[model samples]
Target chain A: MNELLERGPEIPAGTWDHDWISSVVAKAEEYSGRPSHWNGKLYEQPGDVAGVCLPDGSMTISRKHVLDQARPAYTPGETLTSDQQFAAAEATRMAVFQARHSMSEVGDDSLPGATPLESLEDIALENARCDQFSREYSGRIAESMTDQSLPLVAQAPLFPAYSAATDRLLYTLGGPTGLSHRRLGELIDSTERTQRLNAIADEALDHEVGELVPESHRAELREHLTGPLRRGLGGLTMTEMSELTHPGSKHSWGWDSAEWTEVEFSTNLGDIKAHYESWEAEHPGEEPPELPDSLRETFRDREEEIQQVWASKGWPAQQPVVGREQAYYERLPDHGPVTARDQEIAKLQQFLWSHTAPSQHTDSAVDTGGRPDNVRQIGSARKHGRGVE
Target chain B: MDAYREVQRLYAEAMMSAASGDELVAELGETVQRIGDLLPQTAPGERASVLLMNSSLAERLARLPKETR
Candidate 1:
């Protein structure tokens, strides 16, 4: 069974105002034990349903008296005794009464001192206006509905800002080939990290970008991206960035489609880190390894820009390695002849580095803006190989 | 309910006709579809008022057994 079906469908909490609908659905689900369906069309939303299917595959409407004339109808599926039907009906009736009573108490009185008939007319007028509004803003309404369940990081008015901030940081540090893990550690101290984030947030607020990242949502977007969502970004790499930007590519990571929780992403990166650490111990060398045949094939498959990225990043011009298990090459680096272990290590460190704020304890020589002799061993991308500036 | 279905069919036909590049026809179709969507909320009878008054009741009744109603 679909997990959403198991619990019954719901308008995600904090996003919708239709609690009455949720309660009614819950009550119906209680007696039915599962959602109503017709020929496999799941009746997830009450508004979409016309009637319920009986065990014998027939349909039925609701009773009068139980549901007074003013109230809408429900169509519970299969084997609902009159009593169960009554119970469901009674629940709906009570829910309606409560919702109406609450609204009368708190709802805006657009026409003060208006008689009951006038109020009804006003409601009809409002309904028409709302229908017109829906027609005008149908696309936005649909986008909003689709986006409601998504995390703030993944949703609009935030995703673009998040993407822009990340790209800016990466570009500021280095070009296509980002800073090596060791160099990244030295450049961004805790204070600088804090300042950079604050600046990004401020920039987002100051700039009046229309729908790309709305001004109204920018403040909240900044708070979230700089807060919980910030750490999740640590796991991103050049390959991941490529995937994020080219959402339609075959290599596309389907993070947007699914509920990608921060814990799951961090745990995934942690597992990769642990595996790469073990591999690093076994294969301990800085020089780019012999080119893997799969990497060469992947190079061919990529566009001209990616090919240039590979060529400039010190990949061997010829003599590619072959006959290895394809699975072994699955984690191979996008550029350079570096072993999968090296790329994995860099990816893991990148995630960790992004997650952490500047360290309080720093190497005096490294922090003094002076490069240590050992730092030369693990050099920056530009220093390691001749590449396009 | 039968009227609602008829309206829906008419609305769908209007939409299909409008797709053939007539602006006035397209507008007419859009109006028809909007009326069809709002039928359950605005029909003259009490049953039509169900979703507009209490959406939950509409949802529940839509899924419940006929129970000889």
Candidate 2:
């Protein structure tokens, strides 16, 4: 383990799986030892031959490479009983889940596509690689340095740009560097994350009460959810979005503390509606019974149970709502107040009007000071020295 | 509205109502010669503005959003 994985989120109490952690760390360390050129390619296994470099400059690892690696045999810990081991295994599973959840938060969709254990291993690999790259880069800088500034660091591993000299020259000229690799990468990453988070938040909300929506209205409802509803949720962090949509979340309050309550009530109503709708679907011609007070009371009791969970969890019963409302409306860094698309639409809309409007052909004299004072004076007797009209 | 005016109205409505470039394309059906098809033949003077309109629309449509995973 590299510093990054060592500094990763701590395992919750009693959930630590030492063997699982060791395996992940070993895999990552092994990965880090491999040549940087083999970063994404499959490694040579026991039966595999050396990778052959082809004419077009791509290396073929194996023609008959298996899609998944064989799992190693597990060695149980001596001190722990089966039950304790099971608990540890469960904890390991949750850790992997948390890793996948983190990938989703960062909008690294490809990372989550792999098997759960592979996902954890991949994260470990990423952290190890980052650590390795930074160390190698630091060494390169030390080796190449003659002056205070690093003019030769472009040749270093993961420097992002190839022209450190150009950057240095521009810096000396007191001008901004034309190359903006880090900033551009950050911008692109943040934009992707925003869009993914928006979609996830929208889908979570839909799942929360989607049963209530009529089948006929499903398509329209989808559009609304993905469009304006997604836009509304775009400001929230993924965790906040998750809490808002999750029925069992104790601290569901986002910027608005009461929003969770509203969602909870609506969810209860949605359940009742869903039950009635299901019954109606079952018996096509029968008139459904009026919703009972008992059902409402039952859900209301469930709501109280949720409140008790909140209390037991030691979360504040009510969140501080006043200060955060304005913060809720603040746009994500990637999504500005006004976008290039909006400006384009406004421009094109104006162009459409300008071309189509009949009045546009005959220039309005408004810009020419509304047909000159002399022309206006000609209509009145003022030019001929008449006293008043 | 006249056919040409109606075309202009629909185009304007599409531009205004579209939340995205994809939506705009869907609203306005694929017309390769939009300028020739929609620009009023009678009004030669407005041809430049109509051309500008189509080109601007094309510029906007070209700004495709990055595909989400």
Candidate 3:
């Protein structure tokens, strides 16, 4: 048994099956020992085997040789458990359910039949792979000497840009060099954990009551749960998110604290603090939730729960058949005009930005001294100004 | 009354205002109740909400007082 496995996999306790954890770590260590190489760098498994760089600066490889490469067996951890697999599949199915709407939202309905699912699955894979590595190497990786800035904001095209967003969100590669950027990896890991916690928190709320959201409203309800409802829950740490739903949660996605400690924060700690402060400002009399202090912790004082409550709660019974034409409850991430707040927010920002004319030339240097006694006052005109589109 | 918009705004405010421990539970319950009552009286699409709503409705209704109580 590897030394790490003896501690029984350094992962969130209930997020994955024990055997599955064992297999993933064991396999990861095995792959770490593999000798698959192209030139100086190691291949990211067989699928990454592009042709070697030639002297003429061209690259070439036979599709046959690439496929013929003997890659080791690797099962996706996202689909490792049948239930998670089902949920992921259902998530994609739902995305496809609204594929037309998604295409329309993207302003082109001419996508190939399978593009939506394929793109979503790509996103799913990226998320799962990031989740797996983060879980596998949590806290073990080192800090990156490289820049940790978040990727510039992009609209994330319905299906096409899902990947770019996922890539932007991840820091380390899944290769041996992956665990090198400990801080970045930890941040990505925390993010992945945040999503899981969001899902769990969402499950708790959706299942908390006998929700009679009408079928016509089911999609809207689903969108609500995944969106604002998600933002509502996003404030809490992984532990807090879980414990709210599972009061004595024993699960661990690394960081879990109840006070404001600098070390226990995401790479974007300043932003999170600003967000929390803004949230406080936005909700004037409401008490803020308990939150963790650290973004990175080398040690944990895990609460011991002798009894396993893994079976205590589950997600709302999701059905892919709820959608019109049996579409899923919500469109995939890249789908059509989001009837939700996300789309509204985007449009609102665009309107605000377009209307403000921040870049419009102002004769501040010209002074208001003798300026426009009658020389076209900037105020009323700009105020009523039909925007310069 | 654009109940959905109202609910979205209020619900967001409520969540932003929530002081831990599912503080919005009561608000959600009332919102659900009001929407259920009002939507049916509002228009045809609203009427569809009354008929087509699913277990999430039941779940929200069930959850309102159960855990918080």
Candidate 4:
């Protein structure tokens, strides 16, 4: 059973002891012989629920309404009413035994906005919490109907793991075998990740160069590169910007056409900035490290000149993700196994994806200082997978 | 304090993701397939791993509002 969904959102863990349990157990004896209002069963068997403790020290088991909605139609191999449903299905039931233990703290109704202890004792208590749970359960059902509980890849994008990789790559970029300092070109993808990135990178670069933002306005771009985003994105250059902003590009891919969902198009600069701000809030105090002169040039004087040259040049939109993945894997025999050097980066990628942040080129938004447009939906060519950078 | 929690965490870890790096990677692949089968079902909005993976992401999620965030 997925405890997360079963419990609604996660509640922070807390302290509870046997002595406390014993006191509750004693109070709960009152319900041993009684039948719950909903179920005909006696309340002798109390469930092992982590009760929400009130300030007065009495513990309360958070109640969830037992509804068919909370049960997903397909749970690996069964339905709701089956004897085989997860034991956590007990979660929907009013665990009356535990309620009795929690009922004692409310001697008088002085706690403002708090429910009375007597009401807490009753298995049939109804109020806002219960109503909220009902709504949440319905939303859960609707969500399941839409987002199949998982993605094919559980891995994260490049990160602190990729940080070491990015740094080494940066060191070598002046030489060969690295992503060209020039905006290397084209975008193609039947999948969301690759297409989104290429579109973001190319679009943002073009958008920045086209619109003439004055020098002072470009300071943020320099700083943005060195921020927490730099952990995966590396230094601030048009090349680094495009590559780092390629959020989903680091992921593995599936080649056959039928399996992919083509996501096409782009939005303006303001929307892109909003996306960056949201992700930035996700990482506090993680400003990027000081830029070496090479990388910092994007942040320095003549920002206009740099943006202009890249904007004027051509950039590849992107290509197939599978071929890319295969290329990276092919290098494994010669370059060693496929492990990321910095685990923090792997963790960061997973964090971004799980949060459903825009997986494409918004990392470029900070470059132009928040002025842009959506990706152009062109014919999908499809490309990207390991070792392309 | 750290040692106690570490012991508790490791015990749970042993039962959770596989102990060996290769085993864990293999498990991730299998998990991905299983999740893929769930196609169209939204996993929880937040990955529980964020909470487990050092508190940085978790703290961020906590600080943000459910909607505006």
How does candidate 2 score on lDDT?
A: 0.29
Candidate 2, A1-389: lDDT as tens digits = 11111112322223323323333323433323322121222222111211222112222221121111101112322354444333333222222221211222123344422112212112222222232233333323222221222222222211111112112211221211122434322222223332432332233334454444454543432332222112112112111212112212312322232233334434554554475577668976565554455554455344444444433332322211111111211212233455553343334324333333323333332225332121223134322422110
The TM-score obtained by model 4 is: 0.19
Task: Return the clash pairs for model 2, or none.
Answer: none
**How does candidate 2 fare on TM-score?**
0.20
* lDDT of residue A99 for candidate 3: 16
Model 2 regions lying over 4 Å from their true place: A1-214, A222-232, A237-258, A261-283, A286-389, B1-69
lDDT by residue for model 4 over B1-69, one digit each (tens)?
222223222212222221234443343333333322332242321121111121111111222233422
Worst 10 residues of 1 chain A by lDDT: A316-325
Reference-based lDDT, each prediction: 0.29, 0.29, 0.25, 0.25
User: What's model 3's TM-score?
Assistant: 0.20
Interface RMSD of each candidate, angstroms, one decimal? 20.5, 26.0, 21.3, 17.5
List the lowest-lDDT window of 10 residues for candidate 1 chain B.
Answer: B12-21
Rank by DockQ (best first): 4, 1, 2, 3
TM agreement with the true structure for every prediction: 0.17, 0.20, 0.20, 0.19
Residue-wise lDDT of candidate 1 within A166-216, one digit each (tens)? 323433323111454223322221112223333333433333222333344
TM-score of chain A of 1: 0.17
Worst 10 residues of 2 chain A by lDDT: A64-73
| Candidate 4 global Cα RMSD | 23.3
Model 3 docking grade: incorrect
Model 4 stretches astray by more than 4 angstroms: A1-191, A211-389, B1-21, B26-69
